[model samples]
Target: MSKLKVQWADQHEFHALLRRSEVEDKPVLLDLHSPECSGCVNHDRNIYSDPDIARDVMEYTFPVRVVTTDPDRASTDIINNHIYIWSPTIQLLAPDQTRHHEWNGAPRRTRLSVGYQTVFHDTPGHLTPDAFKAQFLVARGKAALRNKKYGKAIGLFDEAITRHPDDRVTVEEVSRWRKVAQDGGVIESTWDHQHQVTTSPLAAAVERFAQTVATLPDNVLMQDWIGKPGTGDWQWYSDCLREVVLQAYQELCNFAVTAERERARHGPRFNDTHRLLGQHRFAYREFQSLFIGVPDALLDQTPLRSERSIRENLAHMVMAEWWAYRPQILHALDRGRKGLPPQVVPATDTVAQHGEPPGSHESLHELLALYERLHLRNTQDFSGITDNELGIRSAWWELGPVELRFRLERYIWHPRDHAVSIDKILDASGHRHTANHRFAARLFSGLETAEAALIGTDGFLAGRVDSLMTTINERADEAARLLSQVTDIKPGIG
Candidate 1:
């Protein structure tokens, strides 16, 4: 009947609250939260202030708010041990500092200790107040179950079911708890409710293509196997080469499809990828807070902008430079295969003076389409390109004359190199140096190595293998180094 008042104490006053708890003979309900956490805000609106929930807080315990990220929060040691630096965690403690309803003398909540980020992590946003209430009741019921308070757990579960009949996840979870209580088995719980994400297409493609390139026979004489040009059939060599290129090209297509799907889920365009490295712009921009501590200001000033642009521009640049010379190269090779004159065919178009402008998904699609056309053409249009063709003089248009071999190598390596650069950019963006990122990088690299083994008996070149491993390690190291340079630390708004 009276206006509800919820008293909140900062963590710095935790000891005082402990003392006050003893004086008042009440337990303490500590809300350990991050200032920028969405779940914490939900607690303020739904859990802390709801008429029913607030009555429990006001009548039964001292409600204390601990912003774990705050520098002045008391007892850094305890705070670090008990509080999740990134999420909202609630702990009920007796006046003697022992936790209420603690099971197995577990020093940590399983979800908070091993998997808090996975469970409670969210981009800052509001949830339905009803959902929030349901979550609280579920959490309390879980605690009761853990403490062997079967009747209390069942009651709380029933209450949560009544409160959120529309929430299937909650309803199913409560039903499971009721079953566990009756059957007398261990209660298994997890905070995470979302499906796990697996290997992304672009990541798979890059690693697979790298493997293909690593297996190419280097410093080996292909001419000996092809035999005298006019006398011996070179179908074996041509077919093998086409197969290698086809694999690489197909992987690119796979990456494109995956990117398209991601675009559909995340929307056609978003700049939230940029905000993982900065403090602003995550208020509701999709995928913004996916990682933290990425330095966006550095990226915008450099060439490592949107990855789509780099892929697009490079695809155009490589196409324009190679397209003019491709016909001549193809014709000469075809002539040799057909037992015609092996006369030199001059390139009709000069090397491009400069790269084309930044590209888009549409531009990349165009390039892939062209590759599809070239790939599907009959082998009669192009064949008989022996190692001897490596000596043909050419320019990168920007760099001085490089051998034909180098140009072909560029076609493969350019995209691969850019993929590595993109990896570096993400590493620098945020969370790149973390265990999860490191694990993913290693998995991807391992897959690449495995695919490369399938390239040929030649095996991955020693240098190429080293390069792939080095890039993965170096990117993580560089990102950590850059993050170390950031000063004047601050937290985003709540």
Candidate 2:
């Protein structure tokens, strides 16, 4: 057999292999276990896993692993090789192949196996050039960080520092990671720059702050900071941090889902849609401040439509606004007198629809044809109607007190509120956050042009008042006119 250098630990395999080697008349380096060894843990998982060490010790020393439980098995061979014994020991066989030399535990170091019944771990000893032991600690620390176990990562990194006292890398690594532990780190780069995300560390911190703002008696310290002011002072920063961002996000998700399902049955124009529709209704008022120019900012005038088409669509929006309040206005006229409203109320009485995009029909041709019919019918009907019809009012309020028309108008403000939100969403998405915040600009333009034509035809507003259905039909015609001019390019869009 060729000569080999050997390092060894353990007592179990040591006994087994040595006995076999002796019988085969081969050199056998039997590892011994004195009740006193200290650094064996380092050797097994780390050293044996290395290639150079595996090569040199291959042929000559039939290295056997051992523990105190089975010494006799290799005990015979151990004694035969003239192998020197030491507990938890490592020995090398001499080249003449019959003699042995031993390495006992270093001075003052205790045996590694003494009081540990846990997994046999090789406690690291100072490693030379390769940074073997310290490198393992570094890797372990990184893994801990990934699990969000900051405390564990810090400990591992600290231990690495102890092992490599002079390596500057240890200091830099720790400093960098400490920031992440405190502030938390999240991955955030534009994926070649398109979509935007705001729900990780940055947003988490914000949510945590928000929790503090929604405080209770339990938040004594936060309450104290705010004094008697309803905690307004604390809101500045406390409104943004998130202790557990994902948990809060799940709650919001649940709330949104529940609300959406309920809203679906309520018809379209729930909030923002309702508000924008109101602006359209107010579009024709001589008092421009009540409506027009409200959506100047946050608009994208880059669509394919021209100035006139926008006004016509906006005019239709006003008609929709009038129709939206029809049910409530009519109901106050009757006072829930009818048994109850039908379950699936048709769109004529509803403010919005959930199914299909606006203007959808079985075929594009069918839809276009319907628009054509409305255009022809609307002008003819408006021309034939008399001024007496204009002065007539449908049932909306009762004699007891408030009229349904005014009360419904009051709630119409709710829709207007949503118009603001919709505008913000649009502006933010389009990278135009600086405009006048006008969400109604495009519709306003369209409404103006549309109203001029409809009101100018034969009868004006004072002389053109008609039934809600007649109004809607006329509005639909206006919608068709504006839509036809839309040119496949919608401008002032979000």
178-270 per-residue lDDT for model 2 (tens digits): 444444433221111011111222222222222222221122222222211112342333321121222223323333344345446543213
Model 2 misplacement above 4 A: 1-279, 282-324, 330-402, 407-415, 433-494
Q: Kindly report which residue stretches of model 1 are placed more than 4 angstroms away from their true locations once superposed.
A: 12-28, 33-47, 60-62, 73-79, 82-85, 89-122, 187-494
Candidate 1 residue-wise lDDT, 256-332, digit = tens: 34443554575433232111111111111111112122222222212342232223333433443344345445544
RMSD of 2: 32.5
Identify the leading candidate in terms of TM-score.
1
TM-score for every candidate vs. truth? Answer: 0.32, 0.20
* RMSD to truth, every model: 24.0, 32.5
Candidate 1: the clashing residue pairs are 277-294, 294-429
